[model samples]
Target: MGVFTKFGVRLLLALVLLCSCSIGYESDIDYSLMPVKQGDKWGYINAKGEYIINPQFDGANVFTDNGLARVWVGDKCGFINKKCEYVIAPQYSSATDFFEGKAWTVKPKGAPVLIDTKGRSCFTLKNVRTVYNYSGGLAVVVDDNEMFRAINTAGETVFELSGPAFVTNFVDGLAAVQNMDRLFGYVDKNGKAVINSQFYGADFFLNGKAIVRADDMYGVVNKEGKYVINPQFAEMQQDYNKFLIKIGEQYGWCDERGKIIINPQFENAFPFFGANLAAIKMGEQWGYVNKEGKITVNPQFQFALPFIGKVAWVKSADKWGLIDEDGKFVVNPQFNDVLCSYRLFIPVRNYVVSEYFDVEGIISWINMMLDGNKVDGMTVTQTTISGFRKKYNLGEKGVSVEKKYSRDMSYEIYANGTFYENVSDGWWGTTTKQLPNARLDYVTIQLKLKDNENTRPLYDAVINALGGNNGKRGSGQYVKVKASPGIVTIYVSDKQIKDILNDNLGWSNY
Candidate 1:
């Protein structure tokens, strides 16, 4: 029983037999036992919507991580699991999803191949021709007549990227491709071009900037294709890390050195500048401003978001909560419908960015505890555990990660502890409270100092700009600040505090 407890008892017996044909299903945001019915033929329902797998399928799919699912039926596709079982065998009309285990189908128009969830196609490609999805291990073909290339299921190629004409999907390590005159460019999976190809239109690089359209307007570059800020703007967006461009449409934020420093009058705007805060929208309403643009989360939400870390996510009377990146409300809007779900399982501390500021620094340690505290000396404890996995990434603590840094130091503690102690200087863990005047104190440290050798490598330039594979947790890697075989530490039952709470949780970004 425990395939999610027989999938929560066949999803409580398929939502008590599809609560009357799943009538319009909308418990409010998070819609998907899926079974929307009517259109594109999708299928599968049960969170009381019943049907379990019925939708008939002409196209559409989901379920994997072993819970198979390829779907399609008539023209092929295959896979399905979670006791809906077919295990793989639907054949192929085209398919997708399986990730690290492989998946890609295609037959009707033919070109894709790479199979494995047991439908076999192996890695064909009939000369490539069209396919996307698959990252880091590479995948993004398109040759035999269409022309794009990016192989790696052993077919090798890793970078071909023909004339662009359309590409996108790479995100961050960059991938916008397009040409034949539609302009725009960005490659870099070895197809090289980093920022080359030129930009007539482009977007997606965020933090380090990128958003170009140039001469016709829109500006900012930095991912090395250089341009610094110029273009001019009419519209642009990078989100979260900032860069909300736009000019004729009225908006501002320049500082990668082209100057604007966030002024253009904003009818809508976003972009970063030494950071003081920002989220403007003006007239009809939208709030959050500072850096002089003024406003600051007062526009009153019907929808809002653009803050991360300090918090943001508005909407009001209709319900949706959280406000802080300075707008304050903390958690006010009241839940009627909200889902910000960001938990790479939370973990950020392990500074190795050397230049010697005494080897590590970015400390804010301010615990008085309680009112909701949670920050155990962590080098990692990963938690989002609220109301038992509240379904954001389908919860169950989904997305807990394990990457141990080589650079990039960020830790912001808030304590509530349960258990964790993995000593290794960088992992003594933190946050495990229950003290109403009891006794349980903690300390944590993360150091960044480089010149002892590698020096400010910026996470080794983010692992060579995401071709990834930084792998280095070894060679005299020292942090020796707090975590040690410590000194006086003892624990007795609850399976040694549930094996130190499964070695301090997972998923982290900071």
Candidate 2:
């Protein structure tokens, strides 16, 4: 079995976090400077939505512990200080956020180098295919030989594992390692196994206990290699003071001693974050439950996120906004999408621009379709036709269905007759049998202009928003075509241009 299968779900979550450039020492994060997006540019904004750092960079990340933020200038990545000055120039192919006053950077066709906060190269690591950030004075690297090793900040190998083993960064003086047999155990700073590799999985130790798996079930284990709570639950995730457990596909809460605090009843649940309340899904709606399993917030939101500080991001209908602890809307639901980081800033995307031919409007629509994964509250390959109709309050007469060659299907929803949505499905013919519940493969909005109206301005706007015909902004390709006289159609889909051509939609390269 692969390492992912052996590590199970919790380790997969940790791996995903580790893979991101924003991964850092959480306690050292400075939330005062948060990254926000304005139009097509990124900048730092305060809690009050005031622009602290003007929108200039192509991309921006959260401020690390050392008062530096990673930003992208064109295709290069660098670090900038709070004063909007370049602390580290845009030179690296990619870079991770600073942790413990040091960061890892990769040069173009060069070895990965560890750099100090002042942009001085400490050392270059060779023969390593993968590198992790330094934690607890040690970092983990996977060598070209596919073996894990621990290295010091000086780039000297502290110790190499005895055999092929998967290792994690040092946490609390120990690191979780998996032996060749795919059994996990804890190893000390000197690479000595303190806990025997017997369990199917292991997590980083916290508060003297680590979650482990045995008999294909999860439980808690102490640092001394003894089970504190025997493996019994199907899954276990340690939150602040409670453990989110799964039993037979349902989620519940349990205390530290494995005492059930809440029955496994909800369809899904989120861990408590920055507050005592956690979001739980009941049927199709989401609500919050306190530590005692009391429903503090009723199930009303279309979607909900974990609480951060005094507020949480929630979805009401198709728009997202902020809500207080009592489930009251502190910020009205008006944004197409909202992103929060470090509980300090909110990046709002307003895709409903008034003029479709303007630069800002075109950019907003492009970002919404490509980056935001949305097209008028419907996500391709996720939102079913029935759900879309229900969400938009579209009746039978509002939507017109068309079967293409008895293999592909399309749903057209008209809005005031000037514009209409073309929802496509069954391109591969597999989804044709799943009508009504079949998810949309792609969506296109067609606009009918006035008699003899020029389409050049709208076409140019789309090209500019997409960073020219080369399509540099995102991976998705867009095609602008004049289907008929006085009718202009712009198709935006995650599918490639070649794949769209295969659909025989009569679209030509611009």
Candidate 3:
């Protein structure tokens, strides 16, 4: 997904608040000097929740690294430092966080302007209808024409476009934008349309993919504007990457291509987390499924959640216990309430097991190593032989290898070996070699390429010639590269991903 498409959603939710004082704990709480409310006044507290600055101000904001915090005196706002002395006396009606040595402030009787630490106006815009403080060296400014444009810190226009468009700060090369038609899309920093405003709604790109909504339906799409999962789902869980989808009243699982990996037979479903297994509900019972949609644990619990490490929280007779993937109890059902906290579960009594944290730390350390060198300095080369027996000159029967090349990562297109129609009727685990110091995660996808016209025969022949050792042959497809450890799926044509998969590279076309 592109950045702008996701920004459109946030921009819509921020319009009214931008015109007024920002609300909510994240906007107001100064974590450095935690703001606490007492009756009608606000005070600053330390991490221990003890008052550091007595309740006096009507409102307060987090302290900046420069040692100044925003405080509301009656109806006006000003900057106060830790010594309880006014850095900038309360005079402005509205103010924002300081960035790059300046902050945006709006006077009681004047428009907003960039102010220096000394509370003096440093710069102002002539016809600024709405403006955001500089971020990533650029701020979004709306002009009198209702058009949005990106302006540098010096107030020079970087790019301008005709609107009624809502623009968001660019991150990771793109920002979400909405055009006059009220559709969402993405734009690059140069203000060029990378993805046209078309979707009804969208989200920021993560792991090279994004969730998009169209015609009141949800689905996942790739950066190239192709629907990896078609827009047929009614709802998606918080973790759409796991492909937990809602269809009508039932929930199920799908692959990146929108194919139903698991039938919509569950009453409810939750997205997969650290492990591929997901908590699913059927009637009053809960269980889990691997990514292939096969039941790893039967529907036997009163409630269950996705596995965090090797264990998950499962409820039986209203009591929660920790169970491993094999459905054996690590912690018997005894807790009143047990919720997931990464690798540990928080019991009802305000305590956690120290043993769980030790395991979590080890997992975290291993993950750090895998992320650094998992794919570093790796190479995959596919060799093509003309045919079987011709090279051997023994008149034996076998398919010939055609051509070979080092696999390229820049392109999403490739060739793959296929399965025989009968041999395709099973599920398999897809795992990569354990990188040094890192644990490998696996996801299961259905083996369906044998039904496709372009891949079936070629893959069938390749598998047969290789004597059915998919792992050995597939190793030639992907050389590892350094990146964050965890799967980032990219969907290509059936032929392309299959080619990658035939060589045992972990990719999904579903």
Which candidate ranks first by TM-score, i.e. highest? 2
List per-prediction Cα lDDT, in the order shown.
Answer: 0.45, 0.63, 0.52
Q: Work out the TM-score per prediction.
A: 0.26, 0.61, 0.43
Cα shift from native, residue 488, model 3 (Å): 64
Which portions of model 3 show Cα errors greater than 4 Å?
1-30, 64-67, 99-101, 116-120, 205-209, 232-510
| Counted clashes in each candidate structure | 42, 0, 19
Better candidate number, 2 or 3, judged by TM-score: 2
Superposed on all Cα atoms, model 3 deviates from the true structure by an RMSD in Å of: 30.2
* Tens digits of per-residue lDDT for model 2, 1-510: 122232122210100011111112245556565565556778765544456898888878777557888889998889999999999999877777776798888866456788899999998765566677787788878754567788888888999987576445666677888878878898999989999999888777666777888977899988898888889988876575667788888899888888898999998787674366788899999999987789999999988876656666677988756677799886666544443442121111111101112224344654564565445555545666666567667664333332211111112332211123344554843322325655555555564434222345544555556565432234444443334434345454444333334243332343
Candidate 1: tens digits of C-alpha lDDT, residues 1-510:
100111100110101111111111111111233323334466665333344665556654444334565566677767767555677777666566665577666655344667676666676655434566564467666543456676677877766655744445554466667767667778776766666666667654544566667657767777777777677666654433345455676777655555665667767643332235655667866777876666655786655644433554566776645567667675555433322211111110110111122112122121211102232322222333331123223333222222222232222221223333334554676544322222222222222332223223333332232223212123211111111111111121111123334233221123
What TM-score number comes out for model 1?
0.26
> Per-residue lDDT tens digits of candidate 3, residues 400-459?
222211110111112122211233324664433312222112111122221133233333
Q: How does residue 450 of candidate 1 score in lDDT?
A: 22
The order by descending lDDT is: 2, 3, 1
Provide the RMSD of all predictions against the true structure, rounded to 1 decimal.
Answer: 24.3, 19.9, 30.2
lDDT of candidate 2 at residue 99, scale 0 to 100: 68
Model 2 clash pairs are: none
Q: Rank the candidates by TM-score, best first.
A: 2, 3, 1
